[model samples]
Target: MSLDAADGTESADRLGWAWPDLPPGELGAPSPMFAVRHAEAPLAPLTLPSGDRIRAIARYEDIRTVMAHSATSRNLRYEGAPRVTKGLSIEDDPASMLNMDSPEHTRLRRILSGTFTPRQIEGWRPRVREIAGELVDTVAAASGPVDLVEAFAFPLPSLVICELMGVPAADQSRFRHWTELFLSTGDASAEDRVSAALDFAGYAAELIATHRERPGDDLIDVLVQARDDDDRLTEDELVALVFGLILAGHETTASQITRGALRLLSHPERWAALVDDPGLTPAVVEEILRYDGPGGYGMLRRMTERVELSGGVVEAGEAVFLLLPAGNMDPDVFPEPESFEVTRFDGTGDRAHGPHLSFGHGPHYCLGANLARMELQVAFETLATRLPSLHLAAPATTVPWIGEALIHRPVSVPVSV
Candidate 1:
């Protein structure tokens, strides 16, 4: 059944269908439906969890074309543009870089780029390691099976981002709830999402005010002092930026760590290999990202003008969903894409697999890629070393997944050391 038909009426397809489906028994594999769509309809129409119907671009080249094209925009406030969810318009949050286009996005991204540079992120390794170590230590000390998502995965990135922003650790739980609500898709009601956004913005405003007064040695303080050619971020922008960073910075990485551990534990051989050689942790992390990145698709983009693709022309104002997972699994890009081989991304030259779109490409590529990688690497290494005997508390197939979200993650990664 077509996506439109599935959306129009209650049907069996709706139950079995997911925009980016992981077929039964295929944990990290992309749905075979993607391969069919990629070949037969690169720009196939699909319905979002928000019930918004839009064209989905699943082929690697087509997805890249749309992402790299200057005419496509990330801003979703334009009239007639398709939206992921109601009450989640970028217009509602003007300070968010996610809502900006062109000069504005460039300006805001430039102001914040310095903080996430490779060098700066590398310098954060020790602290990230420290955080991961502490979390792993807690897991080790647990009396019984522990949900890694609650114990280690979620808190590691949460604590790191909280420290980076100088947010009190005590308030981490509150921020977690706010971010989950804000980023949720079908799981949350429109009123709930709006409430979460308002609460977060209010918190950010107060935090920014505090930073302005105290001016600590944190990213928040740096942002307060940041200027680009004498141009400074406005109060709204500052609050939005911090709110965006806090939400994006931790949530995605946290999901990755949780899923990565699950991937390793599911594949005992790979887990054993990593335990035998910690150096493979980076490669393992990369493979995990390629296989099961948190996001099902890249940010929604609106076509500013007609753009031709393998399937057909995408007219102006039409929403395009770049299915990142589909692109990452394209056979043309990665040989045997279904196989989760850690060494696939290891070698320097021809041995290395092509880059995956998990972090995205072009202008809006993930700003926190380096930091995310460091956290994932440390997470795997620490888990492999500190809890070499760690295993899933239940069968991998039985683990619950939060499928109704912009980013998919395990509800909880239950494990025992």
Candidate 2:
């Protein structure tokens, strides 16, 4: 459907553009508008939720080029750069890595790199499996329909992140609440956003101080030492880095766990296949990442210099949105992209499958990708092994979705075990 057609009766009165609708009955499928734009206007001008105009890059090659190019920066603080919304640009925050580019981004990322290495994340697998198993046991023992998101998806990652960051057990729920409010897209009021930001910053400062006085064997302590002993991180940067880690460490994985479970339950055969052969868990995890990863779009990139793309010439200082979901569904890359076959990435499919861009590409690829994979792998394995009879309590269509957010996820997944 055309943009106007998709907008339906609300076309004339809308304040900002609506995101392309997901294809009917195919959760996470690229909206028809995405395909149309890829063919017609690969770099189509679009209005942001902030009502700012940007060239939305829809094609896989164009999107990849923008992400991989050093000239296209994530730093929104540059004078006259375009923003996703009107408020405090995360770029303006001294503590936000989301807004940093180049040497600075590399510096902060280096500090945390050792913590999230594949070996480090792999070493945490036993702990992750134990956590997943306990949550699954709770669901298995429940008497009636339980919300999988509340019971399993949210807490497993929340606890794991808390452990990694050395957050006190009692403070986890508060951190989760702060994260939800802080990460709000257009839905949260400016006052709410400000309050969340202040609250989280204050809490992080206190936590960092405590770690300084009595360092623990956690990521936070490692950072605190880097700041105190090496003087590598400034006070503001330290606080911001820790805050960013807390927000990202759990929120994305929680969304994936909830969505992945819903995807499996929606396709009983797929769920059964995984239950029958647990060895397929890894392939299933990759397919889940490709089919319906939580990331709805790429982080905003502003062109530092004029660049040529298939769409057209983008002048310096213009912002571009890399539409990752659309690239994930590109038929040129994956055969029958809309269908969610668990084995599609296992070399048995008709077409050779390439890596999905859900975690992003290039220098700023997600730092938590390895940890996220481990959490998801354990989540599905535990579900299939312990609660083999689990099924959706409500129709998949009836599950409510959070609107106007960068990450697309169901509010809850009601299930019976």
Candidate 3:
């Protein structure tokens, strides 16, 4: 039954259901309720906490079609468009690439594309590994049980993104506070969410002004030059890009790193596997992306035109939610879908399965995926090599999760090395 959003209670998206019980039970599993939804409602209607009605697609193939098909568009800026949260969602931002459709989306993405290409991110790998090494060293040197989230996961990406933006290391804690409010859906009021956006954008604006006067060699400086020298993007667009990058660039990856470590450590054998053969780190990374990808429900899109699917027909003006993690759970594509095998993506023998939809397909595919992969690879590899005895100090069920916003992660992963 749909609760009136007018009242205070609202419905949760898919991830909310899975998160309560999500440290991959036994053979690395997805939630039973989540699996049931994949089977029964792979394509069904959904309502956001904002009371916006939309269609949710969970099957592997259907999600790919929605992402690739021309009929489904991400332009959520139209009149009476659906809202993803009670307050201003990324879709509501006119300058955000998340809210724009092609040509405009293409233009904004192109400006930053040169920096995030796989080759470009690879060039930054040495520095990333250096950062990860230092973090793991701290965990190793610690005398007592360490909270991985505090000691390793969170700071690794926070430091990396700060370095990229040329922001002072001192400001990260403030950014983290603003980001939590900005992403809040159920746990925050509309005013609080809006306030967070204003604060975040205001800071970005100040940085833009600073870069204009004296340029530095970082992303913010690059963006400032782009706006001043080439006029490639507007003032608002530049701010939106910087704000989005700062928040999205590291937050999700941090969540993934903590969650991945939790998943491996929960199963001692799995942890040993990675420690035994670091060569398997790549495969383990893919499995983690597939089994327990970060964030709520998934990507949201609007139907610009009606499209037919195996389940039913989606009409124009209707919004479609692509449940990326749910799509990754499809048994038809990934054999014995409930269990998460580290080598599931190995593409060897009967283990050969379809590519995981953790990252959306087509043009809207995650721009920072390569950087994220490298971060995960380096983080885990360093953990295995540096702290081979890393094990959960507490039960997985006891781990605390944070993020009242779109992307939720364990607040702490108590571990002993």
Question: Model 1 compared with the native: what TM-score?
Answer: 0.91
What C-alpha lDDT values do all the predictions have? 0.77, 0.78, 0.78
RMSD of 3: 4.1
Query: In candidate 1, how many clashes are counted?
Result: 0
The residue-by-residue lDDT of candidate 1 on 1-417, one tens digit each, is 443322223322353323433232255345555666666667877666666777788887888888889998877765676766666754445567877788999988998798889899889999888888888889999999999999998899889899888988888888889877876765446778888888988998888888877887899888888732255787778888888888887889898887788888988998999999998877788888888866555558888899998778899878787888888778888887778888887622123435778888888888888888888888888899999999999999888776556666778988998
Compose the digit string of candidate 3's lDDT tens values, residues 82-187.
7768767888778898777788989988988998998889999999999999888898999999999889998999999999887778888888889878777664
* Model 2 agreement with the true structure over 1-417: per-residue lDDT tens digits: 565456322421242122433222245444556666666777777665556677788777777888889897876776776766556546578467777788888998999999999899999999999998988889988999999989999999989999999998688788888767665566445567668878998999999988988888899999998888999989999999888888888889999888889889988999999999988888888888877766555557888899999788888988787878778777778777778888877622123545888888888888898899889888998899888899999898788776555566788999997
| Candidate 1: 10-residue stretch with minimal lDDT | 3-12
RMSD in angstroms between candidate 2 and the native structure over all alpha carbons:
2.8
Report the error of model 1 at residue 311, Å. Answer: 3.3
Q: Which candidate is the best by TM-score?
A: 2
Screening candidate 2 with a backbone cut-off below 3 angstroms (N, C-alpha, C), the clashing residue pairs are none
Query: Could you estimate the TM-score for every candidate?
Result: 0.91, 0.92, 0.91
Alpha carbon lDDT of residue 131, candidate 1? 84
